[model samples]
Target: MHSIGLIGGTFDRFHAGHHSLLLAGLEKCQKLEVWMTSDRLVQAKDSRILSWDERAAELLNFIGEDLSSSLSINSLEDNVGPAPTHSEAGAIICTSETRANCEEINLQRQKNGLGVLEIIQAEYVEAHDGKPISSSRIRAGEIDSEGNSWIPKNSRQGVITLTKEIESKLKDPFGILCEGPEDDLSVAILGALEVAGDGASPIIGVGDVTILGLQLVGINADIGLIDEKTQRQKWHGYDDINQSNFDNILNCINPPGKLTPSLLDACEIAMVNYHNDESTLIIVDGEEDLAPLFLHPLAPIGSVVLYGQPHRGVVLRLTGIDSKTRCRRLLNAFSSE
Candidate 1:
């Protein structure tokens, strides 16, 4: 008989205690087979159950790259069999909380003409506050409140990594447009609204023309308008232009910088500027030309187009390209209020 150990769970949140149990089981058995509960079974058992596909994905993510090489996961309850039994497995590993189900599983295996197998039970892990570490507890938003260290260092890092991957997948890289210093903001605004719609967010960097363009569309976003004269006068001791007419004062208050450079130079900036703040649309307007600006030291890796709009108002010209056609198809998925 193969030394296969079966582990089952809804794995809604895939916490650290679950990971520790899997590691311990794997060490005792030659091969580890993770039986993720089906969505229907999970819904029937737990109040806040994740979908089968999502549960599997979370399990795979939690296992990480190294351990995944030695383990396999499946939603067996939703598969051909009517829930997996210990007869098919060398041993079944369960937490003390679920140990009572072991007898029921064994009986079902016997009825199916398979002999009973060993049942391995692991002790429940305690949180910092003396409460049991559980998915339900974490999902209820009581982990931090109860002072429960539910998120281990590795699991916390894994969650961040998974979140970033999901965010990147959702973002449309081609939707971004890089406008040069000489390029008119009016033209860019028209182009962006034409291409991405009025919902697009425009991030105006240090420039006079770009800020004017943003105001024309009634779009208010952060503008990184630096008071060059005042800054020079105060810092460099050269008082030329009046403080009121300084370039920064004339431009928008927040002078937006290149997303790529800002992301690469500072960790906090990168996480805040580029990560999915889906509510706010981002358009970068900088001093450098569009093509070269996109070629900045920290530009994101993807193919982007630089174009100019001759007209003032938004132009919705349909491109014959297949990608653009797909984009239109995707746009139709969203319903306008």
Candidate 2:
């Protein structure tokens, strides 16, 4: 009879590292058993594992239908899994990080009078940054399955605020200007209130009235930038806005007509949350009128940023290569402080 082998893991994203470990396990035994840890166990570790069925399908596809016949897949209810109980299993496969668990399984086997299985430890897979490949790092968006960066660190570096010396260049408008509330400007911008030109593009409302107006027109902004005031007047309904259904609410201090470091950090936090499909609100202590200073350049391509045009109405700026270039030039026009 073929010697039965055991392997246990969360197998969360099932990347190249997982493939290496499984291949090594398959080479060590004619028949291999994979114990995909239960949802509770995975949650205890990271709380964000892919569903069990998805992980199982990925493992089976990696093993191939022909080799899968000799593979036994089961849910591991506890850390020990079936390794201590499987009488005929003669080997356990794991990475160096999990080797201690294998040793504990063998100790349990000794207590139960079962034979100690050989432990096979797989080498760690390193990313382009020379860090160990892990599911948490994948979820954090540090690297892809092949360990390549989605975007280089320097490419996403934060924007620096410009000094006040070049205020002359900032007076001109960059996008189409509308002259009314959400419903009025919605028609002017050609369905921009609900979504951008692309239906799935995220809308970021950068002023108090802009956010409320978008909601008035049945368009919920993915990210809202509000300072609890309208046109420099203390808005009456701060309590109501505080009760809105935002997944996260953050505060930043940015005085009128200037982009501060705190404002940049808050914008980055909101953008990250938006990419993760979470609704976020940036509650500003001072003026949020000039938020487009950072919002236009920082938002993802295809995103739409709406800010109040004062007494005029709302202005819609589509984020793209051209828009970012214009915003950068305008920002650089200001004196570097």
Candidate 3:
């Protein structure tokens, strides 16, 4: 019914909620002017935010060339951009979070001797967990773009065994292999430290060598999984790993080639307290090698998970969409009880 409706947001990780907002504008307006936050402006909120061009491209891809004429993406320098002064903008679409700002924009428009714009509040999109889907949550690695949670709801109740059929695939490295000498693991540890420097949330260290090397270099992982073994043999220097350094010490039985519910529960507990940043150490009774398969999906996007590769050295794995998906696929391949 409106000629030109305006919608504004960062749309950084574009999720189901973003799509719904866009849909609300398209349904009521012939043309929608989407004011997206500029890269520089959004950086203060989250430095990992995609560039303006990248965000625009995602918008264009979703709206498609056929509807391109109906949609326009403008850079948002501030909360209200040209909206208060624009005589042509007849209506504005926003979420409940921004409703107050839109109301203020209308008051400013009236002050400018322009017609008051109609404000439409878009419905929220909820994730599988029944919470509102948001870019911030997506960034935290809780759910996918479609609002699907990366961690399965009923998955924490069973034991998943890495069968021989999938063992060959598991042998292949899932992340960056920082190859170095066993005697001097400085290169590999430093490599992981560099990755951690990128501001990933809740850096997880798995395996004895990986944690020991990081500890020696004074790099404390937000969460560490250790079994006091390297290459299926007990490492004599595991006593060097200071247990008191971690605030919480969790113990679970995750035998070799199998991931247990106890282990998953521990990961969930640790992650739920991510905001507090309570550093945790999970001392497994068995192998922690297979833990990464679950850790990737549970940790938020941009999370760093480090583990050793036997004679090869350390593997620096940063959890992202592709890596999380791959980890889920491998997780499904496991024979579960």
Candidate 4:
């Protein structure tokens, strides 16, 4: 009698962790049934997920022909899929986080007069920081497929400086600054929203004025980093963004010209917390001027990061490879400490 196994995941941006999980299932059962979450289901969780075809191909390539021949890969439209209902599936495989779901599936199976499945748990593949490697981290550009760090963690070593040359080159990447009358700024924000669409991507605001302006335009940011000052003057414009609005509120000291390791960790935590559809606020004690350096790499692809441009209006940066490369180049230009 062949022992059958079951495992399910979005498998977006597949990595070493996923490989470990799948191999665990293959080791325990002769035939392993893999359920890849559908695109709709993935999008319901996060817009940054890779397409279903892309995810499937990546998994197939890694698993190879021998295992692929024994594997029955199906697109999962629902959470439980066929895990609890399949008669031949005697074992279920998952990581620690998904172990509870496997047990829940067993409970449902018991109710349906089906036998309970043996739950095989796979150990998590951790990154350099010892955190479990996840697709979200990969999409954020924090880690690669094998759980290797991509962005340097020693961002707090030196102060950031915006000399005349740096300022001139970065004056306009997206467009001309929109410093303006209330109506004009509002119009500009609305136009940006039109391009981005409402609730299509996470809005990350980097400064107090930019956050307040987004609030005024009726767009509450998914993540906000503010220092309570504009043009080096004390600003109390964040009254609208009360603590009650965010699921997680963090306070970190990332001096004006430097992006600290703490700031990067905070942003990563904020992104994970924001998964519940609630907002996150990072209140900076010092300057948040250099936040783009971290945000460019930490933000999900297609998310918009908003920051003020001194006298100019808000500058919106859509997170992507180009933006991340630009941020990296600017950081390299900074005088080494």
Candidate 5:
């Protein structure tokens, strides 16, 4: 009987390491069946590298029509159930990290009266720096000098393009000045709203910019609004509040006590009452307010705030404070800009 091999993954973009593994598996098995994860499963796995259609198309392109004719490519995860199992193939090819999962698969096969499965473990390719190269690592922008060499020439350009795009989107406008601990929320909201207002341009600040960029993409926005008042309202009432007194006064005034006591209780008192006397006019503008709020203790008022405006734009802002000084510093920075 001819032996068949089964391989599965998101395969967002087929790389040389993947090509080598498939070829190695085909050499050992008479035929190879490639199972692509379903779109839903891909999302569940947090494999946002690409859309399901894009991933499938790329895989088909990589395998080509000739080899793909013999290779079965289907989204088993979508057809079957959650965490779908593979059929009783002759063997399954997987990486060392997923070896345990392969074992579990074989055990399931055994229970189903299918004989033991042959497991093919592919050796991990390392970059020049001896660091293991993986799709996740590459996606995370960790491609070092050694890792770049191991990448296939054909795929390198695409990877570079993707990396550049992500980097561009993640750039911070305020440069390294946005790195201050207290300025995180202000920086994130400002950056996101700016992108939503603009045409997906890059900014410079810190990781907050990247976080806001991701949020904007979810809303399909090009730019966002900034509502300093609304942002302040939300933060003043939240617990573990640690912002400047000036920010607190701004939050209290802009939304004009729009904050709920429960929220304030959750955020603690210092953030709400710190700067009761400061004169600050909260600015309300942008579309970032449409996005869902990621609640957290001492979280910047508008740190996770987003507003989506159809055919217009999104707005975001910052509110609340742990200290009056920090809030003033952030506002000063904004004014200076």
Candidate 6:
């Protein structure tokens, strides 16, 4: 066995694939040094990517039980990390995407008058849909770390009722409540925005008031859903909100307390547009109160979903794994017909 083996990656969301890669390296070497890409590098690609400490802590927790003594996790600041210059490094484990970089490392080692290190290929893990599982895919709400989709098949095919059995759970805020007087809506909107943060992946507004407040403040959402009513009554002058501001406008008939197939279709389309860097406005013919149930699961990680609570305030939900899991569970409780 090699004295020491090296493995490096962003390792953003520790998954079965990451597990396999680490194990692959450990089998061929006495010790494995895992170099995790720094948060500074990952943020440029997806701000929703977990920080170094958060990712490292979770990774260590997973492998700490039996592999603690054989593993050493370090932050990778640059592309090659220390692989090119490290004196004691023996072999490097890499995925298909990073194989070329490993070869380049050997070239650098040759120039440094050092022997070439072995480049071992790691096992690849695929999601249920036969695609490789990736952090970007998980962040997009396509699949979980185990490669399972959060959305159950055929769940969106028909109308799903928000039954009274789960009404209390629905009423409970899934996110923080930013309370404010109705007259001065800015207080609540601004407060929620602070929590949402400027670095949030995508800001989505799911109510007429929430969309309006965002528009009036010039901080437009990547996707906005509006039913043109508030508190089960006509939001007077809802038309005053500009439709031209959005790159595309889609309409869906999502009756009060019901998630229609059309609503699901519209949301999926909006998410596609969001990926394409286009802004969308989904105008609902019925109430949009229950829309959050779908938004949390459909949105990518780091997305901020905002909706207004009549006489209360704006609710801002930072979409993440926990929120997505909760949404999936809540969706399972819906009565489909």
- Tell me the lDDT of model 4 at 19: 89
Candidate achieving higher TM-score, 3 or 6: 3
Ranking according to lDDT, highest score first: 6, 3, 4, 2, 1, 5
Across 1-337, the per-residue lDDT of candidate 5 in tens digits comes to: 3377888777764665676677768778878878777787766664335677887787778878777766777775642222224454677888888788878876776677676668888887775557776666544333421255311233212211123333343233211121212323444345545534542221111112233433433332111222422333443322222222122322211122122222223223322232232211122222122112111123322233343222222333332222222322322222110
Candidate 3 lDDT, 1-337, residue by residue in tens = 8989999899987777988898888888999999999887898988768899988987787767777889889999997998999877788999999999999999998898999998889989998879999989888888888889676544565887788878998788878888888898778888766756855666789987887788888877789999988889989979988888888989898888888988888887777766676889989998888888888898887788898888888888888889888877777778877
Worst 10 residues of 3 by lDDT: 149-158
Instruction: Find the candidate with the highest lDDT and give its number.
Output: 6
Can you write out model 2's per-residue Cα lDDT over 277-301, one digit (the tens) per residue?
Answer: 9988899888887677667666765
Which model is ahead, 2 or 3, in terms of lDDT?
A: 3
Candidate 4 residue runs with Cα over 4 Å from true position = 1-4, 28-31, 40-51, 61-72, 83-91, 99-119, 135-151, 158-183, 200-202, 206-289, 300-302, 308-315, 320-335
Candidate 5 accuracy as TM-score: 0.45
Per-prediction TM-score: 0.41, 0.52, 0.95, 0.63, 0.45, 0.92
Clashes (backbone N, CA, C under 3 Å), per candidate, total: 8, 2, 2, 2, 60, 0
Please report how far candidate 6 places residue 301 from its true position, in Å. Answer: 1.8
Winner on TM-score between 2 and 6 is: 6
- The parts of candidate 5 lying over 4 Å away from their true place are 78-88, 144-146, 149-337
The positional error of residue 265 in candidate 3, measured at the CA in angstroms, is 0.7
Tell me how far candidate 1 lies from the true structure as C-alpha RMSD in angstroms. Answer: 15.2
Extract clashing residue pairs from model 1.
Answer: 201-281, 203-283, 223-254, 223-255, 224-254, 224-255, 224-256, 225-255
Model 6 spans with C-alpha error above 4 angstroms:
40-45
* Two-way TM-score contest, 3 vs 4, winner: 3
Candidate 3, residue 164: how far the Cα is off, in Å: 3.4
Better of 1 and 6 by lDDT: 6
Mind giving the per-residue lDDT tens digits that candidate 1 earns over 1-337?
A: 3488777777766776787788778777777788787776766665445688877887788788888876788775753233244444667778877777766777778888887757777766777867777777654333432334322233212211223433344343333453433334556665655564432222333222333445555644332232332212322322221233212222112122212232212212321343343112222222221212212111221112222222222212212123333332332232222
